[model samples]
Target chain A: MRVRVFADADWPQVWQIVHEVVRAQETFPYDPAMTDGQARDAWIEAPPGLTVVAVDRDRVVGTAKMGPNRSGPGAHVSTASFMVAAADRGRGVGTALLDFAVGWAKAEGYAAMQFNAVVETNRSAVELYRRHGFEVVGTVPRSFAHPTLGRVGLHVMYREF
Target chain B: MRVRVFADADWPQVWQIVHEVVRAQETFPYDPAMTDGQARDAWIEAPPGLTVVAVDRDRVVGTAKMGPNRSGPGAHVSTASFMVAAADRGRGVGTALLDFAVGWAKAEGYAAMQFNAVVETNRSAVELYRRHGFEVVGTVPRSFAHPTLGRVGLHVMYREF
Candidate 1:
């Protein structure tokens, strides 16, 4: 899979990936009733951020975004969010997206990285990040109410990459 | 120190902490120019949540808020925001606040806990949570724009306890 910063032309494909992945109401914390415009704003907002797409055989299969976690005095560290098409999980799409994020962060002079809310229910994503050096620094208990799982814990992970 | 739910009686002290700690322009992602009323509304907004203050000898030294990180279907796991007065730093007030939050969560039947947007520059806060068994799971690049730190990484940490 080849990953690259998304171009204007890539928005449609990338948006499709985000829509499908988020529509599940499982991985993302967004409102289940989120519209296309709002989702777009949520994913593609502000400055100094990377909205990238993963391509396989000229088809977009995954998407991710990387940007400064915050501004001013604590700007050195960066953060990222990743998503793989439901049909493409366990096939290395997440790993590739993470690799892109980490490489970009390190070269960009970020001192660390942080994830704010990872659904505790998503064990695969948690394991992937843990294997990649991230850790559960804190937990927001019952922050997300899962449809099937009921109340699920959201994991807050971080690493000094 | 006696820790209990915050009431109208604690507003003065709450404002003092917010003015002193949150006013630093580095510890939070919010703009330093926010007014007192706005901060209060953001922190203490009504039922189904609790705001607590730790009082030492009748003076407030620390404060925290516990509530749903997300509303509706995602409101099971509770999220908390804490602030300890700089003058009160080694007093274990933060631990008390955390303990209160965790116990409250456990009693409330949450499966896990997640801390969203933990500032990377806040080493003491991070270490405190780490000692409490929270792990950093994912990092968001440029999640918040800090006043002095330029860009800050937001850490998403979680613990299942």
Candidate 2:
């Protein structure tokens, strides 16, 4: 499946994916109090530059955003977050979205890419990032509060793309 | 320098140290609108089982907390953050706090440590974590808006400790 940048009209499908994903806040570390508008700000509302989505067979299956990882003279690296429809897992959708992110960050001249908070137990995502050459840099040690699990750890990984 | 865990009575000095280092939203990822109480919850209200502080000569130079990174089966790992008074930089205060977190996580049975939402622009802090054997694992590009820079990226890093 080919992936491309999301347009304004594509938000409906993105919202659907987000809506379902929000129900899994126990794992995502997103505000469990998140509403549509908040999701809009989180996923849409590209700040100056850097927002995109992934589509497959005419449906938006995944979404991700990328931009300057920091500011001041240190703002050379880029960062991104990705989401894929539950049904779309194991189809390489996430890799494609990450691929898009890497290309975009490189084109933007970012020195590297960083992911700030990945649930530590999300082993598959961690493995996928490791397969892509990202490294586990630093950890916050018990950050996000999962709904069902009570508490868990998060991972921060990065790569130069 | 040594790290210790204490209650709110220990907070005045802790806040003093943290405020000295993390005053500007530009320095930390916290909201510019965050109040003292909110920041306290963000730092103090862990999953009921983790908190800490760094003291140099019985005067708190820095403070931090650790606990389950998330809930459910994912709770095997821990996440933490540290804030050192600007005056205490380079005195091994941060290293001490981190060491405490590492030992505490190990003793508490966490499998790893993760950092969620590390500001990509915070080079010194990032580098410190790197020197401590952490790796940059994931990035949420431009997830935050800075007062001066408009938008900045967030980095997610982790280590097994």
Candidate 3:
């Protein structure tokens, strides 16, 4: 799979992935009832930030949105979110997207990258980030409500460039 | 000191406090170069959230803004920020504002209050939150840039109602 800048045409596929992930109520803490416009506004980064898609043979397999974690002094550190198509799980689309995001942030001169909330129950995502040199800096206990696990901690993952 | 809903008349005093705190660059991570309108937009809460000021004999001594930490599923947890005039530091203005914010969040049916970022170098602020039952759930290392102290951790403080 190859990652590329997201285009206007990619919204439908991106929204589908976002909707499914949000509705699953497992990984992301996003509102499941989020409207299309709300999702678009949230996912599509403006100006200094960016959105990208991973494609495999003309099909969008995963997507990521990245930008500064906060404004002013905190902007030196960046943050990002990713989602892979459920059916394309083991094909490394997520990895490709992550690689692209890291590269983009480094190129953009970010001192570090921080993921504010990674559901603790999402083992695969945790492992994936760890494998890429990210560390669980801290976990806020009982912050995320996992559908099956009830309330679970949310991991704050970090990686310095 | 008495806490009351923020009014248009209070903006001048509120802006002065906000400007001093942000410019100090030792506590809040807000942009020091933030314009008056930008500061207003960031400090003022719309609709679901509320902003209040601490009045001591007709003088606004402190201010606080509270709202949901995140939208949708995460909205159950509330977040807030406080600012007290430098000259009013030892007089318990911060404590009064904290008390008011906590009561407001509980009355609004929030399950908990989470502070996303509290500079570790800001000892008084940290101690005040701790006294009010907020625990430092996690500290992200070297996330904040302190002008004289170099880099310091930012604490994620939380309190469940």
Best by lDDT: 3
* lDDT for residue B45 in candidate 2, whole number 0-100: 53
What are the per-residue Cα lDDT tens digits for candidate 1 across A54-145? 89998889989998875444566578999888888889999999999999999888888877668888999999999999988666656666
Candidate 3 clashing pairs?
A: none
Query: Per-residue alpha-carbon lDDT of model 2 for A1-161, expressed as tens digits?
Result: 87777798988889888877767864476654567888888877466446677777788888887776544433666778888889998999889988888888888777687775677777778888899888876555555566666556566677765
For candidate 3, the TM-score is 0.96
Candidate 2 C-alpha lDDT tens digits along B1-161: 77777667888887676555454665565544555776677678555457787766778788888887654445666778888888778888878888888788889888787776677787877887888777776555555556677667666677875
* Candidate 2 Cα errors over 4 Å, as ranges: A45-48, B1-161
The C-alpha TM-scores of every prediction are 0.61, 0.55, 0.96
> Alpha carbon lDDT of residue B159, candidate 3?
92
Query: Which candidate's DockQ is highest?
Result: 3
Candidate 3 stretches with Cα past 4 Å from truth are none
Off by over 4 Å in 1: B1-26, B29-68, B71-73, B76-161
Error of 3 at A86 (Å): 1.5
Q: Quantify all predictions' global Cα lDDT against the true fold.
A: 0.79, 0.72, 0.90
lDDT of 1 by residue, B1-161 (tens): 98988889889889888777666865666546668997798778476778899999999899998866664456555678899998999879999999999898888876566776687778888999899988876556555566666666667777777
Window of ten residues with lowest summed lDDT in model 2 chain B: B26-35
